[model samples]
Target: MKTLHDLHRPLGATGLMVSPLGLGTVKLGRDQGVKYPSGFTIPDDRDAANLLALAQELGINLIDTAPAYGHSEERLGKLLRGQRDNWIIVSKVGEEFESGQSRHDFSPQHTRFSVERSLKLLGTDCIDLVLVHSDGQDVEILKDTGVYETLDALKREGAIRAFGLSGKTVEGGLLALDKGDCAMVTYNLNEQSERQVIDHAATLGKAILIKKALASGHVCLDSGVDPVQASFELVFGHPGVASAIIGTINPLHLSHNVRVAVSVIQSRR
Candidate 1:
């Protein structure tokens, strides 16, 4: 049986090795304004801790969180107190969620502040990776805003090891890699519009982390096919993909995802 740890790969030239699947924690903090197929309750500390332990048992080492994920950073800070060194923490800047709403601030100052806050909230001296939480204005945010520049400075200062954009556009992903180390783009069975970004990343030796790999749990595949298996096959089949961030607080689902992901990855070899 292959564990996810067996399939860990380099995240571009960032010097950070990550598993093929990362745990996304949006459901750990916020339950509003989400686009999931069904509603879910936020897991309490015990449940969340169990899920984290299960992830480790299944060999996941990358965790994805953001300030826009309500109190996710703080919760993980407490939950992962002694095990910080075991995982690669991937966070974001420029988007904030409060009072059931979200807002964007990509200014240099806010970017700096967000990174500092994320550090504090995550209880880490240095975040392994920090991506710009873009607000659909991907091109403008990268070109007009100094957000990437600020993140580059933070990386140099050792506050963050790598930086890039969790962008919504192909242009933004390419530009982000041109300026940074990674780009988290949407790539799955339903949407291959960002395929160009993945190809470009492969060519340039940069990282491409995938989001919405399961279509936010609304996967609509053919009747006979297993959605989860198909999703992992499509994601890991691409050589450029570093990891797919899947958000699920359910232990069974997490285990299943890791199993399918490992099967796909190992078969490719």
Candidate 2:
């Protein structure tokens, strides 16, 4: 089994190699209205730095963030300036959270502006991956909006390396796989409704990233079963999964997740 220390793999056909475990930064920015099993204080700068360093040390190279994730992009900009080349940044557009409420915008104009803003906010000249944050109207947005066309243009102009959708429905996921480089879908023990999306991505040779792989901390492990290990086993068991985005602010939890991921991968061998 490939250990977490050597878990890097190609992200579909993007030509970019990424760690099998991507670190999600939603908790780094937002704490309110979140659905975690327990409350957590947002980490301070020092703590954030430590956590990032720990993630890197554990061989995680993909960092998932978004404009809707409070100040996540800004904080990552400040924290990851000198280490830009060391990570593949996956950020989203079309969704914004303001005043504790969420809103969606998939217009080409907004998509372009959002990518530009994300580049500036993350202090990077180019983003590795950008996904349209869907508002549940996935098929409609893909059909009515020019977001995909706009992102393709940006890719041609060297503003972004790849683009896709963080979509809701299986139909939307299939569309995204057909039209983009990857798809971020929700798949976990509690919710396996999106497994077809992963299967489709595999058939199409596109990347599939698992979100809420642990049921967003709501997974209840049976006796003698470790939640982290069980969750990772299920996720990584799928050949289509490029990475599982685990959002954990606690260094201990992060380390344990890494260990479990390594064990699961090794057991698969």
Candidate 3:
């Protein structure tokens, strides 16, 4: 099997190269209201550092986190300090989690504040990519909020490299691609409703990142099939997909996932 070091590709028109599998940090920080099938203990700072180190050693260069993902940004800031150039950090604004519930804020004031807060929490001068964390009301948020415009201004100010939306609906994803640099959508074996978003991203020369590619660990695989291998086959087969974000705190699982991703990509050749 190939390694993540050999599986790099461009992330659409963003001019950023990323591995086919991006390490997601949801599990690294948040556990209160996640959708994982089984309960998991959150890893401490040492474990987190080890996992991140293993990710880099395996050649995974993209790290996805969000303000809503508990203290993920803060943890990553501390863990990855002095090595920011080695990875592309993707984060989001407009969604805040507190007391185990999520809230949306798309106002220009909130957007600006969120970006600034992310910079502080991540201890970075500029965020690589920032996405609007949409509530289910995707179109309404795009139409009514100044969040996208705020992100555009931030990009001009050199605070963010690229911006997009982590949309929940097809219309929202399409609109995000129309106005931004990328779209993060959920696409897995059991649920392919967002395939159109991927197709559109490809056509528009924009980026698309896959979330919940393993169905949030709820996928019911066939007895003989490997879930990780099958999931990568479906996700990486799509030319539009730049990377599939897999959130696992376990180093063993991360290693397995990267290996499976490499095998899938190699098989395509």
Q: Give the alpha carbon lDDT tens digit for every residue of 1-269 in model 3.
A: 34789779998898999988899999878999998899999899999999999999999999999999998999999999999999999999999999999988999999999999999999999999999998878888878888889999999999999999998899999999999999999999899998999999999999999999999898887799998888888998899999999999988888899888887898898
TM-score between model 2 and native: 0.98
Worst 10 residues of 1 by lDDT: 1-10
TM-score of each: 0.98, 0.98, 0.98
Off by over 4 Å in 1: none
Error of 3 at 109 (Å): 0.3
Rank order (by lDDT, best first): 1, 3, 2
Q: Residue 183 CA error for candidate 2 (Å)?
A: 0.6
- Give the per-residue lDDT of model 2 (tens digit) for 1-269: 23365768889899999998999999889988788988999999999999999999889999999999999999999999899999999999999999999999999899999999999999999999999999998889888899999999999999999999998899999999999999999988888898999999889889999999999999997889897887887899999999999999988888888888888887888
* Tens-digit lDDT string for candidate 1 (170-248): 9999999998999999988889999999999999999999999999998897799999999988898899999999999
lDDT of 1: 0.93
lDDT of model 1 at position 183: 97
Ranking by TM-score: 1, 3, 2
Model 3 misplacement above 4 A:
none
TM-score of 3: 0.98
Q: Of 2 and 3, which scores higher on TM-score? A: 3
